[model samples]
Target: MRRVKLSDQIAEDLRRWIVRENLGPKDRLPNERALQDHYGCSRGTMREALKALEVEGLLIMHSGPNGGPEVQQTSAEIASRQLRQFLHFQKLDFKHVYELRRSMEVALALNVVDRLTAEHLTALEDNIRLCENANNEQERELARQAEVEFHDILAEASDNPILVFICQFLNGLIRDLVDYRAGSLQEHEAFGARNVAYHKEILAAFKARDRDAVAKAMDEHMCCAETSMQQLDAAFYSDLLSRR
Candidate 1:
């Protein structure tokens, strides 16, 4: 087994303390010297461990007297960033990410269709209008955010916090894939517009409380997204292999 670094072990121990103590946001952690004594590590090693927690957004460091690391509420942004880093490190390509998204999102859509309210429908309509009227790069970004909002709302409507959390986490990855493949924006836009149409159809199904129609629409939408991503991957890998 690979030997874990002392700093890492210190970090893990501190993390356990946070949980065991039920530390809340703004709860002050033990001072650096205290941690050094408790963990039986050097001051430098203790600081390194604290820095890791700080980077993870679990703790914030303050200076001066009464100054120490404090626990912070974890944000979805933090989780998303960590997940993005992990995905990048693993070299999981855009296609694989899309496949994972399609599987989760399609099911989320189906579950949410019957739960959507008039307010939800209105919000979705506004998002589609934004997409339709987007004329510049800034507007296009707003349109993309609106598109994400629509799905996010659907995930929320599913009434499952776990699903909402997962969708929120994955949203950043989806944005990254879209940005990375923007050289194919025109093609993506074409497919995306079709996706908007499918969204409308799913909304209609929702209005009618037609579960089967909703399921079919979601499945079709995911199938199209999967097909497009696969094609893009094929072209990308083919060019890469040709260069080598």
Candidate 2:
């Protein structure tokens, strides 16, 4: 095995210490000077290690008298934001994203259909009501969030933590790329109406506990979204980019 750098080794050691000590959120870490001396590394090496942990959302570097690096638990929102940035940098196409979503969501639908409880059904209905009541752009944005929450509830009802995590991450990415607020009110209503209808279909399948129907509904829903995104891109290209 290739020898790891001293700085990385130091970072790993600190990570283990945090876990072993069961450090809660915002627990202050040792000062830089102490870490440098304890690890037998230069100040720069210690700083590099700390910075690595900070980037991973495991530590927050604070300044002033009341400040130091503090341990932090990672949130799904943070992870999704970081992943969205990375995907944006890569310039991922809509088709690639759609294919990935279809595969994951279809599987998730099949897995969750039989497992949904009455409580989950009520949560989904609440989201649908919110979407129906959405009037302005701000309310529409809230409705979009509710839509994501509705799907998240289904993913959670599947009793698979990994699937729930992946679905939430993708849902955030799609929301960011779509620019829902940039469109007109009519466009928002059109999109919301279609989404509500498709969700109802999926919910019906879930209610009946039909795995194949759930899979079909999810696949169709993703295809509709993919087509809508393509149309939006075409309109954008024609109206905005072509005018330039």
Candidate 3:
């Protein structure tokens, strides 16, 4: 096994301390001297560890009086950025993204059906309307954003942190890719209409709280999107492959 850095180990120990103590955001951590003494490490090592956690958005270090590293809420934006960086290195094509979404999104919809709140359902309906009302190319692009927003809401409503992060990251990646090939997306007029219809069906399923129907609706929506995009823009897959 690869050797772990001392600072990394120290950082993890501090994280455990936070959890064990049920630390909340803005809760002041122990002073540098105390942390160094408790961990039996030098000030430099302790500081390095604190710095590591700070970079992860788990703590904020302050210098003056009433200052030390304070616990901070972990933000999804931080996690999303890291995941995006990893996907960039992986050089995933659009097909890879769609395939992954096809495999998992149905499960997400099914899981979230029972969990959908009044607010979540309302937001989803509004996004569907936004997509339906998109008239010009510019409006269509905004509609596409609203469509992604709908998926983002679904992911958040799932209330499973892992699912939430994966879905949001994938949705973000797809949006970026679509924006990269905006011309191709614009060429697919039928796609926008079909997408709105599919979302309407999915929304209806969600409103009914029917898990099986929701999963089926989601599966069909993904299949239609993949087929329509591939057929309308013959170079779509090739463009994505070249990016890889």
Please, what is the TM-score per model?
A: 0.83, 0.77, 0.83
Q: Could you tell which candidate, 1 or 2, scores higher by lDDT?
A: 2
Put down candidate 3 lDDT per residue, 36-104, tens digits, no spaces. 898899889999999999999999999877678889998888878877778878756567788788867
State the lDDT at 73 in candidate 3: 95
Taken over the whole model, the C-alpha lDDT of each candidate is 0.76, 0.79, 0.82
Best by lDDT: 3
In the range 95-208, model 1's lDDT, one tens digit per residue, is 676667777887787678668888988887877677667634546555555666677778768887777777776777767765665444546566567767877887788888
Better of 2 and 3 by TM-score: 3
Where in model 3 is the C-alpha error above 4 Å? 1-3, 40-44, 228-244
Worst 10 residues of 1 by lDDT: 135-144
Taking the tens digit of each residue's C-alpha lDDT, what string does model 2 give over 169-195? Answer: 888776776663235224666777788
Provide the clashing-pair count of each candidate structure: 0, 0, 0
